[model samples]
Target: MSHAFLKIYNNKRNKNFFYKKQIIYIKNIIQLLIIICIMHNFWMEWNNFKKNKNISISHIIINGKKHYSNDEYIKKTISKILTTNNFFKLNLTIIKQHIKLIPWIQKIKIHKYWPNILKIYLTEYEPYAKWNENSFINKNGDIFILPKIYLEKTVNLTFFGPLNSQLKILTMYHTMQNELKKYNFFIYSIRMSRRESWQLILTNTIELKIGTKDIKKRLNRFIKIYPILKKKNKKHIKYIDLRYTNGVAVG
Candidate 1:
């Protein structure tokens, strides 16, 4: 073929290839726009479904052992949120935050039933003993505060200790109570001084002075001698000093 003919053929082929590429790009853009429109419509429908009044929560069932807190108080706490929000869109985190504001509530579990029911399972702290003046200690050694109205119903055993010593004091109280119970002696109060010294007041108002070191050993020794002391005018005993290395000193 002639050189001029070959150049013209090449130019025409290149233009056809460019046109095909542009067509493919335009098709891809159209497909992308179609996908975006479908997603936008789906999102709008989803939002409308969530906001529909038919799915709004109508019944809330609270199941738990109520001690200091009643169902009425809990219902009142989350009433505003429950009234305004849809069940499908209700946030469990928000509900948990509201319930936690009540001091008596220890742990909570929330579940949403299909359609319009919300169930909440609650666990309240069991007050095992009174701590210091204003707080109570649970069986798990956790300290919590309660309203003045509920304080009157608190356990008779009172524990006094420094800050951050709740677990230590609570554990000691349990150990001492177990040992004392064998002798029919019940502890009314326990106090831990700044120096870490321990003291106990029995139900009969008899005081026990337990020094800082070797507390368990000293207590064991005292327990061994308690029966003999009871035989000798126990009513006259005001305080028993168990800090000695050999025998206890009774006052």
Candidate 2:
């Protein structure tokens, strides 16, 4: 009976040892998996860092311009700037805002190419007309002042009033010019009335009072009578009133 008890105790001890060994092996495997995962993450992070560090600027491109600026000048100007972080993130809106903030740069687009290239495109404001010498207006009627360099050379039409007023007057003047081409009459200047009516100063020194509404009909009627008046050698007519529907009054 004593020998049998000793044999059973030994068998129980061996079983406990084997169970402990199994637990240790599993723990080791789990540790190894965690280490491998950490190493993989580190490797990925290192590769990304290297790629970012290798980024470079390949070409400095510029577009949408006239005789205003070139790529080399723009590149030089931008290179002098100390903001590289903003370039990498490459927010289009932010880039546009920054470019427009510059006096000569009206609108712009800055683009980034991965693995080290950047491109820049720009839209320069072409001043077409001058409004009272203080501000110059572009083709779209956007008002801006001229740079010191361009102030001397920009031959712009003389205009008056606020931006909205000037734009309206310009549009009307251009329309009238286009329509009156057949009559060989060109408008020198156009003034807007307080009630939004229009008064035109013709190239022949004739003043015309065009009412606020029905301008097309009024202009057509005036064109019909213009040749007759010119044939009668009437050069000093003060004002032609085309506001009336049935008749035109000329002074």
Candidate 3:
């Protein structure tokens, strides 16, 4: 009976020791986990604070003319984006994206001015030329639909082509305009056909047809002979075809 009691006592003591060790290990692990989480959270908060230290925008300034762009429209767009924005503590990328959605904005630069002011520098799209009856194109050959306020504005140089052909046509138009400027004949519009043929209408309602091949050469030839044609014939000539290699045909 004494031996059995001793054996039972030893087994109970061993079990107690094993349970104590497990409990201590679990407690230590939980404490370590809590300390790690606290450190991580502290680091995250510190980083956030560093990135956005300055808060509160005192004044907002726009530095540019509002010619093609609507002032109220721009202000409304900014107000929508700046709900939680402070001058220096803003998500600049998001702000820029929102600003760019205003269409008329060609480019924009935004930054905080000292203590509590935000300044935005803007470059708006000027109406370089008209694309058609309703839209306008900038100097870079990008077409945009202008507001009704600017729809009736005077834009003499118009361009027409297939949807993706604006850039090419604009380039050719510029070149031809330079050649025609000496005679005081500014180009009113240029159209490129599907066959790559070019037709230009002058401001005085005269048309020039430059066929697909050797366009510049034929145009130069016609320009050379245009003075003689005007002096020889004062009659109304509708269109001048510069496709012939040796001579030009007039209608």
lDDT of 3 by residue, 114-212 (tens): 546778878888888888667888888888776777766657678888778889988888888887887687888899988889998888787998888
Model 3: how large is the Cα RMSD against the reference? 12.0
Question: Residue-wise lDDT of candidate 2 within 1-251, one digit each (tens)?
Answer: 99999999999999999999999999999999999999999999899977676454555556676466655655655563424543355455655565666555676766776645566777777777666566677777777765667765775345555436877877877888788877888775567765788777777778888889988788888899977876775557877888887787888
Off by over 4 Å in 3: 1-58, 84-89, 113-116, 224-235, 245-249
Alpha carbon lDDT of each predicted model: 0.87, 0.71, 0.80
C-alpha lDDT of residue 194 in model 1:
83
> Which model is ahead, 2 or 3, in terms of TM-score?
3
TM-score quality measure for candidate 3: 0.66
Error of 3 at 60 (Å): 2.7
Clashes of each: 0, 1, 0
Ranking by lDDT: 1, 3, 2
